[model samples]
Target: MVEGDPAAPYTDATRARLEVAFAAYELADLARAAVPIGEHELSPDGTGRSAGATLADAAHVLGAARRFFEAAAVFERMAGADWELVGDTLGVSARAARDRFAVAEVCFREGANGPRGETSWWRAHLAEQPLEAARDLDDWVLRHRDGDGDLGTTPVSGGLVRRVNTGG
Candidate 1:
């Protein structure tokens, strides 16, 4: 449980999972903003041209959105969320919801068993520096360059970086 918060009812594990889910939600919001609506004119260099988000850019945003959604689903489940509620929220049947997030759960578990587990890192971050954790998530979402940067180099709080292996 988070310290100095008398109103917080969740255990530490649940809070860590919820933090990850919140981060995923933030990432999803960023991905949504990255989706281009219409064509825009590029700066004139020798020839002025109209350019917008390419098909590949749109596809990458879609893929990132899907991954963020899956992460939210799996983390919420880890935090003791009911499958029926998750299904209702996602507009799917409970079984279908479980099936859809199964891969994410497997990937999370595989990573959790590794030496440098994301789950363990989040837990430690939450326990040691809760406020910094929130700031780190905000920084990550704001500075994230989808498909154009290495995750291992993205700095977070305490001089640590993120390293995601989704097993794709």
Candidate 2:
């Protein structure tokens, strides 16, 4: 609303946020090793005032991509010490965040499956209605060791699926 400010110009805070997002995104890209960023990097770029925090944000955000698996791998490793951080770091409910974290983890696994970069966040999801389990789908399959090894496989629908432990 300033007189001299351009009409479409972004404010300092907004521009700073954009810069943060861009830097974080670039870092993720460099690390992804040829993976799609999708919309994960859009989260902490607007925030993350700290390096660890930004990296965590990047890990949580870009974790879904195969490249940033290392970044998210770090996050997954931390679960051993503080599992609660998953929710706070990823910005989701305890369960939902855990699910997203697992989503990122699997994306990396499928992308690289090891300590390498490779993933397709979009190809792993479904667009079906009436939300169903992730395992019900056949096209995508992901297993996370969050609690009791939540193993889930996606049907050909390619929507969101949840991990389940059938050994029970």
Candidate 3:
């Protein structure tokens, strides 16, 4: 009676559940198939809306489903997250997530640089670090404390300074 369709046997609830399964398993898989494998979770999958929902909301579908960390990690990688979806999984405010989004980018870029390239990437990722370091060094030079006070002003703060040699 719903329509002259072949799949009309399914009720609305069934269809909705199917749609959730399709989004998580089918759609997500198709979208990520071409991407190279990496350290992160590639395909986000759930067999039901409750399954498809965030870690915390997953409890509604299955009793053993609330896994906050897993949900956050998956949702975070997504380019955009719907408010309802975020709430279901994270149980956190959409506004909170939006605010943290900017901070997360900083961490993501630094992580991408890998420990081996930390020195070079650190300055680029943190805008304030380079500026502050430059200011301190400049002050040192201007006051004739960097090399030797024989050039200009004498070293007033301290005759010696401690610095780590990062092997630049």
Q: Which candidate is the best by TM-score?
A: 1
lDDT head-to-head 1 vs 2, winner: 1
Among the numbered candidates, top lDDT falls to: 1
* Model 1 misplacement above 4 A: 4-53, 112-135, 138-168
Deviation from native of the Cα of residue 122 in model 2, angstroms: 20
Task: Sort all candidates by lDDT, best to worst.
Answer: 1, 2, 3
Model 3 ranges with Cα > 4 A deviation: 1-71, 74-79, 109-168
Cα lDDT, model 1, residue 159: 30
> What is the lDDT for 148 in model 1?
54
Please count the clashing residue pairs in each candidate, in the order shown: 1, 21, 2
Per-residue lDDT of model 3, residues 109-160, tens digit only: 3433322233323324223342233334335446434455364332221221
- Give per-residue CA lDDT, model 1, range 86-166, as digits (tens): 899999998888878766676665444212233445645665665566566647655755775554432332232232333
| Model 3 CA lDDT for position 149 | 39
Which is superior by TM-score, 1 or 3?
Answer: 1
Question: Which pairs clash inside model 3?
Answer: 54-89, 55-89
Residue 13, candidate 3: how far off, in angstroms? Answer: 30
lDDT of 2 by residue, 1-168 (tens): 122322233222222222222234445445554354445544565642443744665565554443333344333433352335656666656676555455444543343333333332322322222123123322222321235343444322232223332445
Instruction: Give residue 17's lDDT in candidate 1 (0 to 100).
Output: 58
Model 3, CA-based lDDT: 0.35
